[model samples]
Target chain A: MENIFRIIVCIKQVPGTTEIKINPETNTLVREGIETVINPFDTYAIEEGVRIKERMQQSGSEAEVTAITMGPAQSESILREAISLGADKAILLSDRAFAGADTWATALTLKNAVKKLEGWRLIILGKQTLDGDTGQVGPELAHMLNIPFIGYASSIEHISGQKITVKRLAEDRYETFEVRLPAAISVGKDINVPRVPSLRGKLKAKNETIPVLNIADLSMDEKDAGLSGSYTQVIKIFTPKHVYEVKMIEGSPDEQAEELFTKLKQLNIV
Target chain B: MEIKVDKTTCTGCSLCKNFCMYDAIEITGGKAIINDNCIFCGACIDACKFKSIEITGIHEKNFDFSAYSGVMIFIEQHEGTVAEVSYELLSEGRKLADALGSKLYGIMPGYELKEKISGIFNYGIDRLYIADNEIFKHNIDDIYSKILVQAINKYRPDIFLGGATSFGRTLLPKVAAIIKTGLTADCTALSIDPEKKILLQTRPTFGGNVLATIITRNARPQMATVRPHVMAKEPVQNAENRQTDNYLKYSDRIEFLEFDPLNFKTKYKLLSREKELGQSINLSDYDVIVSGGRGIGGPDNFSLIKELADSLGGVVGASRAAVDSNWISYPHQVGQTGKTVNPKVYIACGISGAIQHLAGMQTSDIIIAINRDPDAPIFKIANYGIVGDLFEIIPRLIKKIKNGKGIT
Candidate 1:
């Protein structure tokens, strides 16, 4: 176990779709039937981790990929899904004390879990979760663990001898960086196309027993686990107001085009 | 912290259940029970008319926050050219500083940025802190975060703002974690609460379906990153008027900090940086954008969108459906998962806009929708809408523009 290379992939369970609706009369979110699934971006991270392990195995080395998640009890399903995808082991960090965690607290919780893992080589996570939409957890986790961090990785060029090269996709340019081991990386969706779980893998996932860790199990203080440790607090939540009255252009295709053209000309946009 | 429903006060009303986006509440046996799914967002607490829900254990810590003063903006640049978002942040930072009755400062880390320093002062920055060294030329998360943490400790700023660019998104979180503070990402709005005199950070969450106003009550240096084009950029004073009075005054206040580059060694080594080639046009830079969707039928049909964009001197854009269908690359995608653009005119051809897609481009000045479906959602937000086949309408629009018939 000490000789085997260890890769940890951080995953999350998010709403299956982003098409959330608000009850206009109640001014509240309509959440009765919305389903949850493994975050789409995290699937890529899981795939990349599995690919790294397979690559290592092809080179005649032993490697294992472990998936970890911090969410509610239902989130264990996503962990099992990660196993079906290719992760060798899965861990669920769920507790009532861990609720209401801001990015800082969430990263801190993850850091504690990583420390408990011990002897881990690399950590991978999705660039962001769709629900949170804040890409802060990865870097914050890295800082908490006192390790190097590389983000928005589009591809892994190579991994050899305690070093890994990753291609990062920035806004204006693509940068390639060679980072030392014991580092954390947040990969973008372009990393790889995730494969579907086979029947055998799904059967194995159905029977796999995942260990759940709470704040007490991680040796973390109750105050530092959730809302109490969060540096930021949300005071208000509301839907954005849209006040636009669309003017329909009624006529033939030529007439509609002419009217739009005239309007653009009037506005000095064309 | 602990969140619980006072079952004695709860009337079994499902009002709180509707407010929960996480579906954590269940009405079992005529009582609302908070299950494990609750993230403690407090949305239900607000919805419960009877005040049946409460979150306890949020004990406030006592720290000396009075020592922190002034508002600081991180100046991001590339190849000596300052990013446009930096100026935008400065403009917004100026307002926050004024509301707090404090000075607005700019912190820049780059190599040989002396020439560009003066232009930054025009944005009402009172003092500019410079870290001009060879090691600061390229952005490595480790080195930049260290420099930022050093500056933050030395000059304590109550509020710090940054652009939500690729660099800031990757770098600021590490800095915030190292400094042990709160940093919000992709904030849409920032304002100072008149009573508390704190920075109120507002951002879209749950896939832009809801907006959350956040506050760092217990942390100093409340940090946030704003996306480009989300805020308006206005010079403190006009360029012509500021040249003599404001610029000189601001320039005299510039401070060059000394940082030993040897002390900051990055664990990661930059191998190379290559500019993305082909179809790399930033859609936000264009005043007009012509987009296509799944209705375009196939990838070959995007040539029409490109042609229309070319005729208007704009850039080609695509809806997520089009991009996901492999009609075009992901860079051209305009939606929640893609780049947000607020062009002067956004022409959507054959797109039935989803809420996610509309979140990206709904801010555009003028939106024109052309779709065969008369009830397409794009038309709801569109300033001008056309109900017809885009294939027939686009060619005519492109030909009319190309014929120089509508030009001055």
Candidate 2:
């Protein structure tokens, strides 16, 4: 029998941070009806995971991939899209109890869900979710799982049998680590070229029934599912105080050049 | 208050250690490390003329809750080894603990972290509240928040602290939510009020503009994430009175760790320098910059700017263009995409600065812009403007600078 690898990739849907506009009057994110998309970094993670599974199948090895997310019912679209991209399964950890969860609670719930899944060969993650840009989940998940994690991975090499070695990105140099089976690795945009899902794959994903698990279903303590279990809370979410008032850069070269230099020099920039 | 010594920029600047009346700094590996007992009086930081010393860990304090009590530091670890930031938090914790007339505790979750427990004895922790398991190793927010909530509910500490690393950032917010407590991220300051016995949580708001001080009057365990390199990590001076009251609460903590074998394959790896672990920047004080941008067109063209910069005894810079185009190293990018510089003279050969681009380097003393675009933002800020193609002006500028005829 061929050695099989199972990969779980974590993705989050967030209000496009770049597109996030604050209500000028209230100074809060304009959430009355906002456009949301899968976090940019996570797309890299998903694409990389799909790429790994394809490579495994190409090499005549067993590889199964799962795309998992924890969000509301509306968040199901991203998973369906992931399924179309060749994820073996799509799992959602969603419930009213998970609402208003902090990073800690989200991590724990995912960890518990991972435990429920039991056996897996590789856990792929994005370096950060764009919404918060905290870049904490992967390392935190690794910490909670008590496994060696290679962070900000740029390349994957030497994958065979029960062992995998990845090129971990570090300050000034890259270090290679050979981790045993069963490790969580967070990848960045530098990881790989993600493949676009084929039409057939997208069609199949449309019919797939993604599974959803709640705290009650997982036998999780209610206190641990939401705000009760979190260590940090956003006391308030307000718009930034100093808005970049979109100063247009349009003027004559000589005068504008002089004006720019004077302002920066006064601010003591250059 | 914290004073960060960018070890690389520290040119044996003992002014910090010498100026520190509390004797908080000790130079190691050719860098200054703040030892314990350093208070945030801004004395040594102000004395460091090189400005290499940055105050990060310190935040404002809110002392409104006279009924608050206890100081707690979240013990963050990687692969069973505790991170140094947690210890720094502990050092800060002791002061908060004293102000509350209570004890300092290290809150951690894991299995078999006992070997590391001995180190906290010298840090003045009154207790080690630990919940460990095979599943607890990965920092899953749900599991950890739940466990921490259990621990906090059981013990009811007043102040909670975590390092501003990835793990703490993820988990702290969860714990704060569960407990309905207010939290400040990347806190640069933390203190306690003597009169009210409450914790003060201060963090920068509006992209490091104003300092926002928050207080949790009704919530237990007021929380904050302390930036690294602010508070001094005190060397154990005396710990005769220190005690480790271990609370073994494994009853409710879940068995939640699961491991997945990872695939390690990629076309390229992030250069180690980008991660900055076990390493530091050594170019914080370079007098001149010779930066390039996507305007150079490719990595090969970087040689032009490199040669020009080399001739000027300066370094190279880039617009976010160069970094995004992958034409140069991310470290070399000059815009908001890379390091913010205030060098004596910044030369923008082909760069057209965006507003985000200018925000980072608007402080350069003399900006010389050489762009074909007369409308380029760089020209607007340039002290000396050259409205010519960089491809044309650069070679001439290089020759002129080499022949000592460029600047006037």
Best by DockQ: 1
Model 1: chain A TM-score against the true structure: 0.95
Candidate 1 C-alpha lDDT tens digits along B315-372:
9999999988888988898977777788989999988988778878988888999999
Residue-pair clashes per candidate: 0, 90
Model 2's i-RMS, to one decimal, reads 14.5
- The Cα error of candidate 1 at residue A212, in Å, is 0.4
Interface RMSD of each: 1.8, 14.5
Candidate 1 docking: what grade? medium
For candidate 2, the docking band is incorrect
lDDT of 2 by residue, A1-270 (tens): 345688888888765333323344543332233356776667788888888888888888878889888877767888887877678789988875665455566777888888887457788888765444455566556556766566767788777656777875443345666676677788765676567888888987888888899887778887666555554433322222543332332345444444544443454433
